[model samples]
Target: MFSSVVAVCIACFLAYIFNQRSREQAGDKNGKPIPGPPSLPILGNLCDIPKSHSWFRFKEWTDHYGPIVRFKIGASEHVIIAEEKIANDLLRERGSHYSSRVFLPMAAEYLSGNMRPLFMPYNDLWRTSRKLMHRLTMPSMANSYQPAQSIESARLLHDLLQDPRNYERWLQRYSGGLIFRIVYGKRVQTGEENYLQRAIKVVHNVERIASPGSYLVDVLPFLRYVPYPLAPFKQEGMRLHSEELDLFRSLLDDARKELETPDVLKRPSFAQTFLEEQEAIGLTFDQGAYVLGSLFEAGTGTTAAAMMSFLLTMTLHPQWQEFLWAELDAVVGDRMPDFEDIPRLPRVRAVIKEVLRWRPVTAGGAPHTLTKDDEYNGFKFAAGTTFHPVQWAIHLDPVLYPDPDQFDPSRWLDPSFPTYKRPLDKFPTLQNFSAFGFGRRICPGMNIAERSLYILTARIAWACKISKAKDSQGVIIDVPSYDYTSGFNVMPKNFAFNLSPRSKLHEQVVEERYRYANNLIYLKPKL
Candidate 1:
């Protein structure tokens, strides 16, 4: 209750300050600034931006005002690209100029010590960090991690068979475990395990703090100067910062110690890899630790959320499940699906693409900043302007995707749509404006994320029957199209669904694969 009051007070205070500031003429008559909602004195549409699910509202604005729309909130200038072509032109074609990140005071500065790679501005440090991460997540190197991904996914299938009710938790664990194990060489068997808990807490702290419009300190940098006694957010930031330092630093130390043990070969961990090239890469201890944390956070939450969306789509649209199952049974038979089977399972790939488009994990996108003044379609865009590649709008564009709201995997299967083709062996192409972001700032973990989704969803389709849950009255529960939790990455709210083994033979195959998968997890450590 007190936090709510504080947040309201902060918003009111910020609004008052915004009211006092004079609005600037953003562009000349010949090439006026992009059209947006009319601004009030200093507030400049600050209050117009919704506190939750702003992506939907931004999409609405684009629908009304056209592809490119501009808005000002306090001192910040924003240009939202709703169309893919414009997003591609600016965010992809002109990525060199738009790759830098906007200043994040509360999220990136105090909480993260300005070290979180996702929030870092484009610079030598960011470049070096990016290179280090590329060594692990690059397509050529990503194949090495497939064995772990496969085993972890198989374990997820086994868990689902045992306890389908907690399917959400199992998916979360799978995503968290795979990334955590890959990064720290520590497994997350359960949600409450020490490694998973610490990693999740660190990520939650940053997400809560970093969300746009969450902290007044982010809007008005001077508030950070307030004394610790009065500034509760600062105090919280300090506590989280201390916790992060202790947790990540200790993990780094442990990895170092483990590598030095007698007869112990170095583990396949980002920490060990980073340590090996630490001097060559010119990164400090803190940089390496934060990189791991960033990878785990990005890889886990988004992947888990997308998987959740997939389950929800299946439950809501069970008619398609039969089609998917038919495809799975014909192509994969009774065995668990693997990366090698991706080519044969075009329907599964189409379903994954549709799910990503229907509910993008990064709906509002990680905000990118303009480094210099630029013009787009006769509109003047000043430097330092924040551009949001609003996925909700882009994916729903009528021209690009007909009947965008409908969960139709057939769109990808159709020959007319060239961009909808299933990724052949390699992961989903990040070249276009499909999810995983765009341009230089596209997800480095795209290879792993796509592969994880494919392997898990394909296995689920092969092994289980997904259908809408029914009540005592034998009536299917109605699921609203957009019933979802609100956040930077929007996801489906908890919903009831029936998931059971497709057949005894399928279950047996799943069991055998689960047992076989153990070899990947146990054997890798020995070597």
Candidate 2:
């Protein structure tokens, strides 16, 4: 009878708490400012979220609630800002208060202990990570990687020339090479020799697990306590996480060995740069280690997918293909395209922008968690809600780009083409797009990715004609319908294309470069 009374007392306390929260939400004059979506009793709009693609569903809600919409999930409230104008205000203008990541129950509570800097809240540590990235990879400072980009792009061209069936692999190799080389001062060999590939493959598993609603462990944190025998999936995931740590640890050791050599530090890649800079900044060794790892996560995956998109877009649009070749032939000619040639290739840059816009690397960016209560438009966001602004929706906004679904870079050529560029600025580049990210979360490796993408795409288009293959049935294959792999980082679904030298001279040019590039650097993978 005493225990029963205690249970009733507990129920009464929960009821009292819910009543107070409801009263706060209902708005007496003393209540918090802003509008909110219609909420369910306790669970709120939690039931509506996973019913469809959350990003697409959010697009519909954004239409109803303007740029910033207030919605609830479980007991949490969030503000979704779909409008770029508003995003600019909050993400850029109000960065200090607005930059914090929302507290994800599973991400914060169970999966990682929120060790990842991307999920880390805005604090001294987050500031340290941000400062380290700025110190090492600031826009002016990141040019140290240009030489690496050029060498890797040449190797990428040779790889495509040898075996185009796996163009996707080449793109991944280029991205991995850039980041590993940048941070660790270690070169990732092309073809099979890439040690970084092992690291990449492992890191991708973490990405796959963290994608939207991919695991129930992220939702029901209690499930983590389940025994291994009953929960095989958790066991497998735990095994994968262990393997990832081993992989990262191995790279950290590898970087230390290369550091001893001293001669290998050409551009002072991100790791090398940080080791030197962090001492002045008062960052700890653990901070440096995780900073490098976070750079790896931010570096290779999404940018590689974007490169794959460029190749896919080229395969899909023959007109654009023809146009890029014309520019390549006209500007750079028989010689290879370099950094100087990028500015002259306006349409190529526009195409890159449009492709990223169409199928963004992150369908929505890595979720941003709110730090404190704030009003967005008329909506109120609580301190601990995840905000995932859909890049597809933002890129395809009709008001921003008319007839947005189509892939017409020519629209970008419309001198009045309103991009994120400073108003009236003509030249379009990756810098104009938030494809990297917003505010504090902007990709630190963008400089390396941009230079790599520019050099490699220009070379591929210049040296070869990109066209789809024919199956045994003799029907012309389309690139998009071919195959696509999806997770957080999406890419062409393993599509095949034919690669032949534009001329015998082009072939010789590729071969000659390949021979000299033998000294460039490579590491063959073990199976």
Candidate 3:
């Protein structure tokens, strides 16, 4: 009762304070030189943090600040880029200059301990790590995984049809299974008692610890001076770190043992790629473990998150779902979508494009570090400044995507629309989505991710009638799209929906293709 009263009081106080600032700065007022929100005390707009999601917070600031908003998160200063053109200018044109990741003290010591790339500082180590990711994720190199990507997609369709209620789990299974197979020539049939979940759970534990208030050790480094008992986060972080070391190293050890038998090392994955180049790269066994672990964290979570978002969107936006189904029906008919089929499908491609835009996996894309002092528009960014991609704000910008909140693929459908570009994997593609990141830090798994989405989305829409399950009153409860979880990976929290076979031929097409594709994946877990 006391805590509730205090919380209410605090909310009232903050609302009162913010309203005064909001009113005064509602319009082009004192005319601050740069476009941004009005500051209040040491916190600035930091006190006006958004609840539910980061996108809304970013939008709030963008509305108040314009395209380029400068703000503070604790002592650190960050520049949020909202406009698409400006975002491209910063993330693409100046990506290399701003590709370095900030030294997250909380993550480095507690989460990765130099075992992951997401938090690793930009240097020769990161560059080498980036090279390894490129071998699998870069478009040209990514083509090598088409066999694995396609097979996994077929498995995704098979599993979903069997247990539609477990669609969310199945999506993760497909992504996790594909990553495992690609990395070690193994498959993940289930997430429970499954190496993928155990490993990913550790990553999730680490993500939870790194939340803004997860530990004060992040904001105030002085806390590190305190003893372990005094700093609870340090203790927790170290415990999580140990778990990470055990999980990733255990997986690598299993793969290494398996490599002794068949042509395991010959497999195409970040792990195998790194192993082949380990001698030349000069990465120690421990470092190699972390690098592969980073791939697991980066590779598995984000892609699965996007897929869940895709499912949610399809359920909510029935018209777009219908259009995609019609497109799939017309284009592929009863056949499964393969790598070659990607280019031929335009409307399906547009759906992918819209998903990346409408409900992106990451709200504010991975923060970028400025390598050199440079000028963008009139503002000069100093070296070491971590620039935010602001994907959440940019995707919702009115100038580019009018009524940004609306789930409208028609924006891309209309050729007259200025922001309309070619669909991904061909001319315009998913790689362009800032969510995977930019320049030096672009996701290396983009190709495989695209192929995975294409195969499953094409098959799902072609085979199943995915509609929202209505409640007792016949209300369209399932149709209302849901949002991502509170965690770093933006996933559809959870929902129940109805699904059915699109046609008689659809089942045969799925069965024939899945049987052929299923045999291609080989899981090799120790007894």
Candidate 4:
């Protein structure tokens, strides 16, 4: 019986491959095939896809094959968009047809139970989730969370002043605490908090499982149907799903309990709003829990990673730090910077924009699946084609950004550069920034992320001096400009750096502000 079953599976796999090949041979009406590297029979481009840092390889392909390139792995076809205008033309101007996501059997099904909005297809459920997220994260609504963000920023300054060696930990705590407060009406006081650690683990797991070629079952979907005991990946996915669900449900339950108390001094949170309007929003309890959980997951690490890149940039290009300090001293004087000061501080804003464009957190753009057949520039693509608007390629395009590898903030500040725009205040802003993403599926948390980046960047520049570390010999240590971790979202690896207060008075102000923030009624308590 087992032999017969094995024989049948092989037959089915062969038949599927043959059918796919036949469809490819039948040319589209236009008969203009997309350009790409050569592929072999049966395996297609499976051997070409790297297990890590695939973005660099994709950029190389774009360089050789023009802006739009196509390759196949197994039966699936993938396209890479390397130019900014073409990405905008398809993913934004024609978003309705290119907004859906590719289906990953492990990450989307077993691990997430189809509840992770990032992996969901462009269907009613995804639409509902996006609508609910927009309610809390839109620009107008995002402003309501500034007080919480300010409180967390104060803590960040204090943490760095106390222990500058663990600057990465402090950044993680700041982003985690702010997101937790906005999502569950709770605060993450330290980096070791149980909830924060668990959430970080969950995010890491999802990124690992969802990465291209991470799991064989993702390409060969039939493997998912094997018996649970025989399939280790299936068992692992199920275990992770249960743990993630428990975490989400527990956080939601705690928020619900807090809302039931009349004298709780209600702090506004996504959890509270969702619980109150879950019925009206047309999502079940589980769906709402995942929506809130998704917010926490998406917002936590990406912001912290970008901030890490900022620190790395400051270390590498200390000249920019002087530019930032000059702006902050002029616009923000002695007090810590806030949102109202953002418009007047163009250099500070420019530094943030340059950091994002220089080392984008998501170097490989998020994949968008074509929901219907489409033609662009006389080339035809069938429905179900996956598109990756490679951020690494577009941001480093030599034509759009001359001397693309150089860390230059002047591109946004000077009229001589092609990227420059007039009225520095509005031009250097993060709105519609390429790093945040494109189209209808652009990051909903962009407003919050931008605000966090601005406040942190400004305050840090005002209070601290960022420089390269010195050894006992008083020699400056070297920091690798391109050394980054391997993941969909990457950060600079731990490097030696010196973060110190600019003056004794600056340290005192950080302490005072932290104390004042602590006294606020909305700042206490944890879920």
Identify the candidate with maximal TM-score. Answer: 4
TM-score of 2: 0.84
- In terms of lDDT, the best-performing candidate is 4
lDDT of 3 by residue, 14-48 (tens): 55565445334432333434566656543445565
Name the regions of candidate 4 deviating beyond 4 angstroms.
1-29, 261-265, 523-527
lDDT ranking from best candidate downward: 4, 1, 3, 2
From the highest TM-score down, the ranking of the candidates is: 4, 1, 3, 2
For each candidate in turn, the TM-score is: 0.92, 0.84, 0.87, 0.95
lDDT of 4 by residue, 1-527 (tens): 58547844774586477547635653466658788998765556778989888899999999999999988766777889998999999999999999999889899999999998999999999999999998878887778778888888999989887888898899989988888888888878778999888988898888788778888777766676677766778899999999999999999988899889888777767898888877899998888989888888778888999999999999999989889888888887778888889989888888888999999988998999998888899888878889999899999999998999998998999999998887876878899988989998898789999999999999988999999999999999999998987777888889889989988888888999999988775643222
Model 3 residue 409 lDDT score: 73
Error of 1 at 479 (Å): 3.0
lDDT of each: 0.79, 0.67, 0.69, 0.86
Cα error, residue 78 of model 4, in Å, equals 0.6
Writing each residue's lDDT as its tens digit, candidate 1 over 1-527 gives: 67655755666576556545413434534676578888765456768877777887898899999888888766677888887888888988999999999887777777888898888898988999898887788876677778888889988999898888798789888988888788888877666788677877776666556666777666666566566677788788778888998888888888889877878765668787777778987989998888887888788878888988998888878888898888887887766788899877777887888899888878887788989878877887767788988888989888888888888888777757645554543333333445988888888788889889888888888888887888899998776667876666667888887888988998898888878876554334321
lDDT of 2 by residue, 1-527 (tens): 56545544554455446544744654423334544468665446666766324666677777676666666653444667676676677676767766787554344433343556766788897887777776666666556567667777778888888888878788888877777776776766653664676677756765666665555444333344555555555566656646655655566656556657756644345555555555786766555666777787777887788878877877777678787878788887888777778888876777787888877877656566656666654445555556666675677688988787778887767756555342323367777367777776677777666766667677777888877889889888766632555566667677767778899888888878777766764332111
**What lDDT would candidate 2 get against the real structure?**
0.67
Candidate 4, which ten residues in sequence have the lowest lDDT sum? 518-527
Regions of candidate 1 where Cα sits further than 4 Å from its true position = 1-26, 264-266, 418-433, 472-475, 519-527
The window of 10 residues in a row where model 2 has the poorest summed lDDT is 518-527
Better of 1 and 2 by TM-score: 1
